[model samples]
Target: MERVPLSEVVSDCVRRWFQDSLKEAKAGDVAMQVLVGQMYHSGYGVARSEQKGRAWFEKASRYRSSVWKVSNKRPGLNASDSDSDEVKENIK
Candidate 1:
């Protein structure tokens, strides 16, 4: 069998969310899980697999809450000034 580079594997994985491979990754793996969901949701890297997309999206959202602390948001994480839950909650 031929071997594929790690980067290539990741690129292909990102290019498409294969159900079998998605199953191998735990829902707890937030980043990959989210990407899988995105692939389905936006048809970005995969077909418009909404069922799979929604499932993974929900999993990623919940998983994020579980692992993340309500701290200051950072720019690298794509945190915007308006993206703070605490700020939003406090405003209401």
Candidate 2:
């Protein structure tokens, strides 16, 4: 999948989608957290902040570790469970 450049993702709806994903990330959705990290890293729909991106990525990694303890499988960072095409696109 081709990535949508951050400069090209200026739509309000896209921004809202990222905001919603961030909310889900805060709620312990590991995949969403990674997506949020990607967004932050690239400044796709938010201010670019490598520190915040790394933080989110670390959070997601911790969550994945917890999940692995229970399921014996890591929650891999893939777009399989994404609800938005934009997420799928950006996550790749």
Candidate 3:
């Protein structure tokens, strides 16, 4: 039986991390998008790809919301931004 090289194993793990993060980023996960961008920029989990990094950073920037708008536009953990009953009935 032959053993896999340590470098090969480590590279595989990093590549998997990149792939999983890419999936989340594609699904509108803003944090994951930024992470993917940073990973690309620093060659952390994948090869250094500055072009892809910039593109992902641009995407994350687009998703950023202003502080005032967060109350109205931010999605909850389940990815739903539905207004609460109190918010719906306001002026209380």
Q: On lDDT, who's better, 2 or 3?
A: 2
The sequence of per-residue lDDT tens digits that candidate 2 reaches over residues 32-92 is: 8877777777776788787887787778767454321222122233443333544677889
Give the Å shift of residue 87 in candidate 2. 22
Off by more than 4 A, model 3: 65-92
Tens-digit per-residue lDDT, 1-91, candidate 3: 9999999999898888888989999999887777677677768778888788778767776765321122222122111222344366695
Give all TM-scores, in the order shown.
Answer: 0.44, 0.60, 0.61
- Provide the global lDDT of candidate 2 against the true structure: 0.66
Residue range 1-92, candidate 1, lDDT tens digits = 99989988886866545554366447456655655665565565567777876686576666465213212222113112235755778899
User: Which of the numbered candidates is closest to the native, going by highest TM-score?
Assistant: 3
Candidate number of the best lDDT:
2
- Looking at model 1, which ten-residue stretch has the lowest summed lDDT? 70-79
Off by over 4 Å in 2: 1-10, 65-92
**Per-prediction count of colliding residue pairs?**
0, 0, 0
Number of the candidate with higher TM-score, 1 or 3: 3
Models ranked on lDDT? 2, 3, 1
63 Cα displacement, candidate 2 (Å): 3.1
C-alpha lDDT values of all predictions: 0.54, 0.66, 0.65
